[model samples]
Target: MTQPIFKDMLVLELASVLAGPSVGQFFAELGARVLKVENAATHGDVTRSWKLKAEPADTDTSAYFCAANWGKASLALNLTEPEQLQQLYTLVAQADVVIASYKPGDAERLQVNYEVLQCINPRLIYGHITGYGPDDARAGYDAVVQAESGFMYLNGDPGGEPLKMPVALMDILTAHQLKEGLLVALLQRERTGQGQLVQVSLLQAAVSALANQATNYLVAGQEPQRMGSEHPNIVPYGSVYTCRCGGKLVLAIGDDRQFRKLCAILGAESIAIDPKYKTNYERVQHRQELNQMLHQLIAQQDRGPLLQQLHAQHVPVGAVYTIPEVFAQPQARQLLLQHPGSKPGLRQVAFRLQGQQELDLSPPPTYDNYLS
Candidate 1:
């Protein structure tokens, strides 16, 4: 594959927080020259303060900030100022793409709305990330959107509190949605010699993420119920058993063969042969009974040997890990990164292009050392 797919493109980012910045960051990683513009007078992106606490090996940069803006250039200009606003317009004239996530009406106030900018740069691919609809002024943070879009109610245990995901999953989904739209826009621009608007919202992203659950409700009239770690339609597909050594492990058996094999290994072949627990649909219908019986059988086996046995059979299984444990894995170490002379660690690019990989982890801007 060619190196730096967006090598010659310039992206002007007028967004903050996760979704909008994430879109720009992805393009930057793919080789776009991204200039992150923040209002000089404000604190800038909200995520800069989203850090809980500084790590000991701190570069005085927020850990959250490093996750998205590692390799981008930064320039601060208060858009309210006439000269600075004109400078931004000039930048937009030169940029191949422009992205923003300001609340509804803020773009028009700042003179960076798609209608306004598209007139200046005919080929500029513009992306807008919003919390709700373009005109909705409600705050569109992930948890809030999760609650609004029926996503939160599908998480956690059935009888327990409806849970929100710890990470900004809605925002992440919206970012991916925006990225997909922009890529398509870029391709279309290549053909038509014109750019178009790409818009995504956290509310819409949450609805899109409903994936199977939405279909289940639409097709079968089955409202999704939270099953904790368990999959609603898949039987024996969660951490359902405690080993003899007292450690818990997930047992992700999909097909009938895997289920039969699992039952055979547990010395409970009768369960697999039973008409009520034979096929996936039947097993899902009787999951509670199946889990109870397997739980008892699984307790007879040692954790180490049980895991090894599952691995030998190629059944999907794993022990849950804490955050520190997750990063301690060998795969995690390979992706850890640090900027030159910076003392803290950050996550490197998620993957590499086929061509030359630029491992530049330039520390996120300090505001004082603004990018040219």
Candidate 2:
């Protein structure tokens, strides 16, 4: 039997919504015993109410809440109550890590601040997630950070109204950063026997996620523009074209050879000979023209036959799959698990350690009895 990573480690999740809970969920997936603390006065996590159209309006369970709070026990407590605060203090004394998404000064007021918790348990790893920084009190909404951090500017079509990502990208990145920070803190405590404060903000995560786009602006003095399913650096990448069957196919032609092969497979070898489309750099420079040419060609043909040719030549082609189409896939089914009382098509935490992917499935807790 393979032992889980961070087995028996305790995580006190004082966070809510997506970011902090995401970190806790990752820890839980990694074998930590995570206890999610919700505010007794509120509707627990705000996401508990972020229901979709098909979900039961009367139920507290939600896709948004379930997405990040799996495999954790929930406890709702009022910080104002002395007995409840003492109960939390006892829990903190036993916990190895605490994750919080409180606004600027709220942590200190709630008495879950790092200084206080570390005093109670010197080995406690404290993590904080916020909108901008410790001094900024603004709430961290995904679209706001996406817009503020230049991420939105880099998304969507070049001339269309700048669009925010469909998913909570900034929060997701913040979770990854928090997870990394906590792991590092745990490692540091193992060596130095001292814990430290770790902080990550949505703005920081958004800016950092720019990757090469940030580099282009910072190092080369070039602002990134929206490309709309097109690659900024490579040509023919993200070039989606509709087929005769009304299905969409995307060609991911990275290098010159791949482009030449695609051209040959499409019986448009003249495209490969053209100076504007001969090399990767040339193709990038003439992306619009090249894509227009490929789009017309691919659009005229059926997706099935075109994809068969592309795959035979190994041109890295893929059919654009809708969400339902994605879930219907066999591989997607293998990645899914039967989580009770929530969504029917539940996905397992994405990790494949030693060819073993699924964890011991546990439903998210009902935080109902905690306040009572």
Candidate 3:
């Protein structure tokens, strides 16, 4: 295994849940000495118990916690205690980076705000991750941020009620942004020899990730709606057909040529030759009729042959895969997404380093009980 990237860098992580811990996880994976500070009485991060009911045991075997907390050292400390606070301060005085996820005023109340810590060590890169922001008093949550950032509006059926994604997308996006901020601050410190405060808000991250949807609204003055797995400007850009094997295919045709090829592959070249479906605009306008025609032909067909045919035709298509199918699938397995490990067994995830391969570190620390 290659050496860790931040092998000599010290990171003080006070973040809990996803956003803050995710940043720490990236740094730790890159060889940073990440010290995760948590309070024992409060049961540390609540994610340690957020397992689904079907999981073996709910106690401390939390997938959510383990997903973001891997590759870091845990130090349970009560900030309310003077001795613990002193030790934390000592850590802060030596740390190159400090990540916190407290609410607007909570950091100040706990005396972990950037200003307080910067006084102790002027070179400390302090990162603040919040829901709405430290500016607005609006409370933050995945669902709330999803709604506020217009993410909920673009998901789900066109006429149906807007909905947030199943996962905490905002937190994950904010974590990525926090990682970028940390890297930029590290680079800046290299030049100025001074550290600065970095901020990442869930709302800002969500809005930024809206991409073309936000641009459409701003430039075209269009109110985007949930299209129910359909593309706004492209025909055949959604679910193609349900297979006999219970699989499904989603097809996206970038231009009229691909659409023509798709029709030819389906043995329906007459549809492409028709004047009404000659252009992309016309095809998009007649998407429902085209989808109905394709669905009728592909309904009983198996996915394997259909995918093979589509690949031969150079059509952009994919089989809809379940989460379990994703890991067991060929491409995912080839990417080394699943790493072999002992204790709990197989761990699946991508690595942080650009060229480094995945390494199975020791099993999760038994923080509640001392490590054996």
Candidate 4:
């Protein structure tokens, strides 16, 4: 079997919550040795306390905590204390990378900032995450960043109040950004033999991920509004319909051909031939009427047969799935990682290298195992 990459690398994770830890886990998944340094005074990472009602209150691990932290050892330290700070510095002297998410001045105050740590190990790559930027002191929260970054504004129903996403989307996006930056820094280190600071702010990451939505405004002067699940540029895309059996599915008919195929399958070939619905542009212009007609036709058939027919026609469609239904799929079940005593966790490293075998990783660590 091919060995996992980064097996000899060492990473020190000084971040809490999602973004930084998720990056650490990414490296850990690639076979790096990651040490998660949590706040001793706080009893460890903050997410350890973010448990659901069904979770045990006495434990330091939570479902939220397990979401990003995997394949790593835990170390709880009071960084404000001189001795504990020295311990971290000792580790930094031999570390390859350090992941941190402290607010602007907190790391400096604790003397664990990149400036100080880089002095101990000139070749150490330091990855930092911030709320705004290096100059901003405000703490970053995912929901608040989602609102500030225009995501909340573009979400939700047309006339309803703006809604935050179900997951910590900004944090996840920031984590991915930092991962890419750190990987580039690593590649650069191979040439220069020196490490540099890699930084990402939640605000910037969110805005950068705006993708085509940002272009719709900047290039086309279209200020995007909440259209629920609808796409601004595509008609019949993101339209949801319920079948006679009450199962719901979403459509993503991209081009005129797919739309025509959909119409043919629904026995609405006349609609496909109509001048107003002949092309994607015209269909987009008359989307309200087209969607209404499609919805009614779809609601007449059973979902299973309709999905099979659509799949055979190469039309992009997906059934709306609940959490349980999602996990029930073979693909989703294959990604699950089972630890001996803890709740099952999903793998964060979704991409596999060619010829790479399944990774042998440890479960997310508990404070009791490493708090000394």
Give the best candidate by TM-score: 4
What local lDDT does model 4 show for residue 238?
95
CA lDDT, every model vs. true structure: 0.82, 0.85, 0.80, 0.92
Flag regions of model 1 displaced more than 4 Å.
54-60, 343-353, 356-358
Give per-residue CA lDDT, model 1, range 3-121, as digits (tens): 67778899999988778777777776667888889878875666666666545433435777776776678888988899988988898899999988878898998888999999999
- Please give the range of 10 consecutive residues that has the lowest summed lDDT in model 4: 355-364
Q: How high is each candidate's TM-score?
A: 0.93, 0.95, 0.91, 0.98
lDDT of 4 by residue, 263-311 (tens): 9999999998999989888887998898899889999999999999999
- Quote the positional error of residue 216 for candidate 4 in Å: 0.8
Better of 1 and 3 by lDDT: 1
The residue-by-residue lDDT of candidate 2 on 247-361, one tens digit each, is 9988788888998899998889999999988999888888788888887888789988888888998999999999989988988887564575555434435656784334665
Query: Backbone clash tally for model 3?
Result: 0
* Model 3 lDDT, full chain set: 0.80
Q: Give each prediction's root-mean-square deviation over alpha carbons.
A: 2.3, 1.9, 2.7, 1.0
CA deviation > 4 Å runs, candidate 2: 340-348, 355-357, 369-372
Q: How many residue pairs clash (N, CA or C atoms closer than 3 angstroms) in each of the candidate models, in the order given?
A: 0, 0, 0, 0
